[model samples]
Target chain A: MGLAKRIIPCLDVDNGRVVKGVQFVDIRDAGDPVEIAKRYDQQGADELTFLDITATHDNRDTIVHVVEAVASQVFIPLTVGGGIRQLADIRRMLNAGADKVGINSAAISNPEFVREAAEKFGSQCIVVAIDAKRVSDQDEADKWEIFTHGGRKPTGIDAVEWAKKMVTYGGGEILLTSMDRDGTKSGFDLALTRAVSQAVNVPVIASGGVGELQDLTDGVKLGEADAVLAASIFHFGEHTVGEAKQQMARQGIEVRL
Target chain B: MRHVAVIDYGMGNLRSVSKALETVSESAEIHITSDPKHILDADHIVFPGVGAMRDCVSELRRLGLDDVIREASQTKPFLGICLGMQALLSYSEENNGVTALDIVPGQVRHFDTQRERSGNDFKVPHMGWNEVRQNISHPLWQKIDDASRFYFVHSFYVDPTDAGVIAGTSRYQHEFSAALSQENVFAVQFHPEKSQSAGLQLLKNFLNWDGQS
Candidate 1:
């Protein structure tokens, strides 16, 4: 009995409603985050993450209400990401019941914010979300660069080096997402995950490009991630968190099943 | 009327703690306070902390809650969590060695993943759910299976000088003290507030406990 690899289901919420398709399974009112969060909790999900993909300024406050409603009922750790720019945003999300906040573009713009946030709120709650994209193709040498603005904007910082720097700045966890495989169902960037995981001592969460149960297992076995986060497969009712854990357990990965 | 005061010394989130406790019982009053006077008035005190030991120590002294915690833990059902649990020890290796409350005779040591064999892909912060082997029977373990998994996130583990106080032990790079109990005070390395059903059950038992082993 040892530490089990965590299976996290990420919800991309837009304007307070879950922004994903509900065409897969028995889900009523796909926009209601509380109902979906409750369902995931019942499925024995290790943790739940809600990314506020909401863009409009007027609807920005909607995610807070959604977070507050979900936090009251769900007992596990909750993480809220997307648009976390300032320390006040972190406090607001935490006060609204989020256990951790993910900082993306803000960290790239001002690395000192990470150090300040970690000093104020502790590194356990400060997560540096790194969006990594391959700088070279499959046949060439493995190299990745940091991407921002939903993986649309590119930064010159090397993904591996940036991860190390973030950890130095008190980023307790690294949420590494492969821009190349994010929505393609191709699988996680194992090489990139390994590079970052090996370079730092903090927990690295492997996100993006999870197509099937095998991909989740590969994330832990190959990527060496402390946790695996997926959006589509689980959100669309194609697979449940319980089923994913079982699949990982069957593959000899220790999971809380 | 039972009241639980979750000590807030300018660190981490205390709402989840208060919220978890509130969910355990509606009749009991739960509030997060940095005031020592209000803390001592409560029936039970939950010391919840996160962040560096140096900061935790500095804040406790700055707010004069160190003495309050010592006094409160001696008489009531006091619960120390995460950084708070580490603070109960004499000192820690973090921040290049920081002196702690010295309540539980022990020295907090780092995981030292770089030096250890760490053949098992051992990582720092030891984050996530792991089985906690029960070393002694206690009220908090009520309705919870022995060796049950609890959520944890810390880089250091407690090494109590007095083995008798150890209630549970878990292994990462090596087996270390995961739970400690001395008189009326009980501390855990894991975040029971985030441990789900087993965690809530422990809190429920604490609400009903009378500080008697």
Candidate 2:
């Protein structure tokens, strides 16, 4: 089979509502998660990833219902993350028709969960999301650190090495998000993306800093990412999947138009 | 009233296919039914799939819609999309020690990039738009232009034993058949619903097809 380029729109659901932000600042509501998901699915989005970014403390049931509602209407793959701390959470999400479950803070807090989840539900079901921030100091040159709690805390783990380890521990895929470039509209962190892509054998989705079509092209061409994920550009009507695929085709990147 | 019963075998994308049909024929009644009687009574049938070929074929068997589909195909119109198209073939390499619907005399094989060194840069599953080149004309291609883009997401391609059934072709690293039509049977590797205007037009032609008449 040929490698398929996936175009995913990340929905940051805060308390059952979809929101978009940069560096977790200037947060603005987008729309209803179920409504937006159906619209994206109609617009030809390959997959949908829901990140419960509200720092869920007591609203787990609401998020689960949101996932269930969206899954019922949207036939495509639904991936749920955010506040996913335990195997039970993963089970709830999967039972709610989630094809995959993404774990970021939980995976870092206890890396064993990644392996255990893989063993229980199979390797192709668990995804380890790595939110990384670039360190600028010359002494810390070429270093990428993992961030937790919605990019609020640094995990002190090297992004590339952590990604390699995640795959080794049976993590299905790696979602590499560049916190520094996120919401900057500059582009994906190609350096970090390339490092992780080369370090891991599994598929890597390049997220953050996608403002223009070229950024997507760069993510696929230079970063060697399996997929290019964006929020604002797709959410705010800046570009559609058809337009993105048109641009990817111009750059010779295969995308389902 | 022309009714198109889309067999919902619980293994395919029925909504998108139904929506595409709705766009084509205003009177096209799309029923997502697993009942063999509904399929046998329908004027036409469309099988849309996305998942394992074995599971899809098995679901059709478990539901006992195989004979109904075959019977309808002999006298009415039949269209298969993606895995639905693959399911119509003899067998697939996905599930070991299994047989497919065998409606078409061919096997589905994985896209061999290593044999042909041209698709090294492009990944597998080939999810995107590639131009469809017409090899032979069928009613489905009535209004569609040559080289019109269509959406496709599949890892394997169909290799039919009967070359005359090949109706359309597309290329990634190597050229392969994209659409096939034999008698009343029509199938395409691409998703017509997701293919936009060109795809909608193809669906429209299929709705207006007077093959039986």
Candidate 3:
């Protein structure tokens, strides 16, 4: 059977409330996490991811409660990310009913932690999130560089190289988010997504800059991503998950409708 | 009230499986336990597992649940998921040839088909939703539609020796058994608990099924 391209609706949670922001700042509350997640589940979302944007010590417990509430109501797979610094943090999310734990800043800070988490809790449950930005003419030597701390600090690490390393280190999946395109609603960074998707042996999820249904199809076709993730379009009800899927099918892309 | 025992050897996600079973039944009792007595005495047993084969095999032997599982398979309705399905085989290529429960005569092998042959550079871990084509009529496939997509996350695939036991097949780079049915035992390589509507229907059907084929 051919694997169907997945449509994922991501929720950014801050202090127990589902929120949306532009480029990780200027946050605004969307709705309750559980309520939003249930709606996506009903709309035939293949999976749901909850990103704890706060990523602070005090807000950690809040994310756990949010994950628990959402998991109870939504039967689809749930991925929890943000502030997953250590094994304990990953354990906390999984114990709270998260099917997978996504590591971003923590993975960049300590790359070996990705392998450790993958080994401890099978690679199937470990997702490495890479936030990258394309370099301009000034840095001709590098096309893309890794960014940490919500795309604020830039590392010299190459995005494509980092993606290959994450997979070799046993990352089951890669969630590649483009800093240049995130929240812009332009479209996914097809060049970057294609490079990383070809570089890894696991599934790559193209995220950021998805404004229309065409972007979803482009992500799977041009970007070669196994899945496409978006927040604003789905959270605001611009297009339902069914509509996006119908558009994908019309474009000759296999999607579970 | 039918009591379903989800055999837990501390390997995979039991919460989602238990929660889904609870959602499917109003009067049935779902218990996640590693105790041998609870499994043997339960009306139905569901074996669920994930992670490495070496660890899974060791845990089952350490808890002495391997023998208990063997006995319960013959006495009641049994359902295995993911690694739990792999463990029912005779041996696995994973963990450098680990011996399994030998409940079913089969071997688990890694999907080594090259991309050049399939024309698609399919990734290993074969992670995501794929369609399961049913091969035979069974009670477990009751309300669920044929060729329904189920969520899968695994690197190895089981090849049962007897073709008669093969109940359903799925494609990766090539076709492999997705569901196996033998006597009172039925197992699947995908996670029905996470498959949404179609998966819920399968769980509900299992709750209402008897041990008979």
TM-score to true structure, per model:
0.96, 0.73, 0.96
Instruction: Write out the backbone clash pairs for model 2.
Output: A2-B123, A2-B124, A2-B125, A3-B123, A3-B124, A3-B125, A255-B128, A256-B128
What's model 3's lDDT at B92? 96
Q: Which residue pairs of candidate 1 clash?
A: none
Pairs of residues at least 3 apart in sequence or in different chains that clash in candidate 3: A1-B171
Give the candidate number with the greatest lDDT.
1
- Tens digits of per-residue lDDT, candidate 2, B78-197, equal 888888888888878875635888888898987653443223433344555578988877789978888887777676889898998898998865788899898888899988876667
lDDT (10s digit) by residue, model 1, range B56-162 = 99999999999998899889999999999999999999999999999999999988767432355456778889999989999988899998889998889999999
lDDT of 1 by residue, A15-68 (tens): 888887743356677778988988888888989999998888788899999988
TM-score of 2: 0.73
Report per-prediction Cα RMSD to one decimal.
1.7, 5.7, 3.0
* Ranking 1 against 3 by lDDT, winner: 1
The CA root-mean-square deviation of candidate 2, after full C-alpha superposition on the true structure, stands at: 5.7
Residue A51 error, candidate 3, Å:
0.1
Backbone clash total, candidate 1: 0
Q: Give the Cα lDDT of each candidate.
A: 0.89, 0.78, 0.88
User: Per-prediction DockQ scores?
Assistant: 0.65, 0.10, 0.65
